[model samples]
Structure formats: structure tokens, C-alpha cells
Target: MSMKDDLNKLNETVKQYRDELRVQMHLAQQDVRDEWDDLDEYWDKFRQKLDDIRHDADGVGQDTRETAYNLGEELKAGYERIRKRLK
Candidate 1:
């Protein structure tokens, strides 16, 4: 698939996981909550990057595209970590 398709799929998955975790965050430890806060900030930035890329695909550079994809992957992993901890 193309980078746009890949990022969109990743975005959806990450959002779903994030929503699930948010519901269970009350059970999370302080450190986990802190990490969540950091990831939440990152998520906003990543979403903005994704939006920029989607709106102006030709204007965005390869490096920026890669960075956004990498950030999404990291966010996915971070969400999974918190999910495991909550369980």
C-alpha cells in the first residue's frame, strides 16, 4: 500500500487502542498516567503531521513522511505497553 494508506490504517488502529486505554486509565499507575500524558502530546503532533501530509502530499518531504510513520508506530507500541500494564 501507499504511505497514505499505511498511515491512515495505523492512525485508525492507534486511535482505537488509545480510546480503549483511556477508558481504563483510572486503573493505571501514576507512572503509566505520566507516560500516557507524554504520548497524548505526541499523538496530537503526529495527527497534525498526518493531516499536513494528507492535505499537501506533494509538498511534504520523504523524511517528514517517514518521521510521521515512525511516530505512529511508536505511539502504537506505547499504547500496547500501557494496555498490558493495565491488564
Candidate 2:
């Protein structure tokens, strides 16, 4: 093919790749948002449990509190990671 024809082909290929990438990115964003929604639900449950424990301080065991704390930290880290990825 002539140089001009080759350049045109390359340009077309790049455009196709870019279009595909955009669609993939959009699908990925939706998946991430769905994951975040699920995490938010879990977070709400965790918060409710923490509040219950706080209200009944003496009834809650040390192990339970520690587990909750660790889980909360993990959730926070996961959330931060997702936020960073979105950015």
C-alpha cells in the first residue's frame, strides 16, 4: 500500500481501539459502582452493630470489638483503593 493508505489504516485502527477502550472503561465503572454499593450496605450493617455494642458496652466482648475494628479498617482501605482507581 502507499504511505498515505498505510497512515489512513493506522488512524482507523487507533480510532477503533479508542472506541473499544471507552466502552470497556464505562463497563468497568459500572462494575465498580455496583461493588461500592454492596460495600456501602455492609458498612451500614457494621455501623449498626457497632452502635448496638456501644449502647450495650458491657455485653460486648473484647474479641467482638476487635474483629469489628479490624473489619472496619479493611473496609476503609478497600474503599480508598476503589476511590483512587476511579480517580
lDDT of 2: 0.56
Measured against the true structure, the TM-scores of the candidates, in listed sequence, are 0.94, 0.59
Best by lDDT: 1
Per-residue lDDT over 12-84 for candidate 1, one digit per residue giving the tens place of the 0 to 100 score: 9999999999999998889999999999998998999998898999999988889899999999999999998
Candidate 2 regions with alpha-carbon error over 4 angstroms: 1-28
The alpha-carbon deviation from the true structure for residue 86 of candidate 1, after best TM-score superposition, in angstroms, is 0.6
Residue 4's lDDT in candidate 1: 81
- Shift of residue 71 alpha carbon in model 1, Å: 0.5
lDDT of 2 by residue, 1-87 (tens): 743343344334433433444444464677776766666675665566566666877787776666555546555555655655666
